[model samples]
Target: MALTFEFETEKVIQPWRTITSLDTTLLKNWAKQRLDDAHHYNMQSNMKERLKEDVLKQYVKSSEILISVANRHCESTVSGMFKSVLFILTSAEGIVLSVSGPQELVNTLNRNHNLGPGSVFTIQNAGLNAISISIELMDWVYLTGAEHDFKLFKEWDCFCSPVRQNGEIIGYLDMSFSVQEDHLLLAGLFAFTLKSIEEELGKQDQQKSIYEHFQTYRLSPREKEIGYFWLKNYGALRIASELGLTEGTVRNVVKKIYRKTEVSDKGQFIRKFLNGLI
Candidate 1:
């Protein structure tokens, strides 16, 4: 996750120096405006692609495609030299788009972001602390849940940069290291990986096709039945009793079913099961 330092637009022209300006806050409003402009550019760039604003659930499983792209990038470019890298793919409102990195880190991000149901801070929220609180970090938090939000960023010593596509915020790539000077290489890696991630998400969106992409989450018979019952407004107690099962056992089964369905709560389980994550 990128911590918000400060941005200063007037200081430099070089892209490298421009990106790591310790004086990041100076660029504030103008930078935000630029992001909006970037988003407009992105929309125009992908304007030709099918838009399913009403269909595709933002960031639900974007990671499947996103992580695949990030993995290939690390293996090919860094050769695991990243040692520790975390890639978070998110939508415009800060919802996790996809995720990958060291398995442990990924798990930690997921646990903290909790990008399942009743999540606010849409994909765009990712760009909130554009210079600091990476779009990927916000989105990851929306997806996985967080031990804390943007408050603890600096303490972690991670620099966050937004990953954009055609100008729109898609996700971000992050690295955690103790030394502030390491920001140079770490920042560079974020930029490169960000590009790869953007390209991959676009390709995945094009090649897989949403319908086919989401087909991987086929629900089981038991899970389906239980889900259907729950959706019909039956609580755990009622459903379990009717099914001649103990409430605790039923609850455990429900938890497993939820995991199987990739849902954070009952509402999303029903929505995804019946309609879609979109």
Candidate 2:
């Protein structure tokens, strides 16, 4: 059976409502309260030293898949008119993992605002910008101009949403650009990009589940290798060609896998795997 991925468009698209139907009065009051809280904590707008190279490498490696998906989306979908916009990915704790967009725009933001990999954007570090506030609320947020507590972000509009995997927030994706007439369309695109990221994460979880479940079967290394392809619906001839084995050997391995997995046939194996009965 082919892998199946499903996501509710309505649920994924719901966060854009925060942008289109924004309540200025309430947002202003909230921004004021956040600013007051930042003042109480004596937060500074100055850029702090970024994470050490080794530490930053680990965070980037952990978010490799997320960064890859975001980069592809930016290149394919967010180019042209949105080229100046910066897509920032940060760890759940708010350390920037990667920044992608127009090369000139990325460089400008890095030089002027310290918006680059390893830079921290937690509430304590970056005050009340969209990334920090989204982390605080664990939800999507849109902040523009005066809504930001820092002078650096006063000329930009930011839309941010948390990226989750296995029902837990793993990181955040933020799109920031200078104020523009197409702000609403930009926000919609940001939401769609986030939905794509989460969908890929969901598929990763399913693949991981398949690997872990296979581990419990006590199959040998070779058996496990062949069994994986079988579970993915690979026929004996294709599995043999892919694995560089004779078709007879591949068929023999499949029979052994069926016996070990207690499944009478390929269909039974797939059904059991999908239902978590394996």
Top candidate (TM-score): 2
- Report the poorest 10 consecutive residues by lDDT, candidate 1: 140-149
Q: What TM-score, to 2 decimals, does candidate 2 have?
A: 0.74
Model 2 per-residue lDDT tens digits across residues 1-278? 89999986653444532433556675555555443464543344445547888999999898788778767775655565534777888999999988888888778767876768999886556666788878867888888876666776777888898889888999998888878646776877787788887887787788778777877987788887788788778989999999999999999988988898899999998897778523
lDDT of 2 at 148: 68
Candidate 1 structure quality by residue, lDDT tens digits, 1-278:
98888877686333432223435564454345333444443332111122244434544455455546755775454455645544443345444344455666556544564422222222232222332344423321111112112332322345445555545665454444433345555666666765676776665453334334334656455555566577666888998888888888778878887786678898886666445322
Worst 10 residues of 2 by lDDT: 11-20
Number of clashes in model 2? 0
* lDDT at 152, model 1: 21
- List candidate 2 segments past 4 Å from native: 1-46, 79-83, 220-229, 232-253
How many clashes (backbone atoms < 3 Å, residues ≥3 apart in a chain or on different chains) does model 1 have? 44
- Determine the C-alpha RMSD for candidate 2 after optimal superposition of all C-alphas: 9.7
lDDT for position 41 in model 1: 33
Per-model TM against the reference: 0.38, 0.74
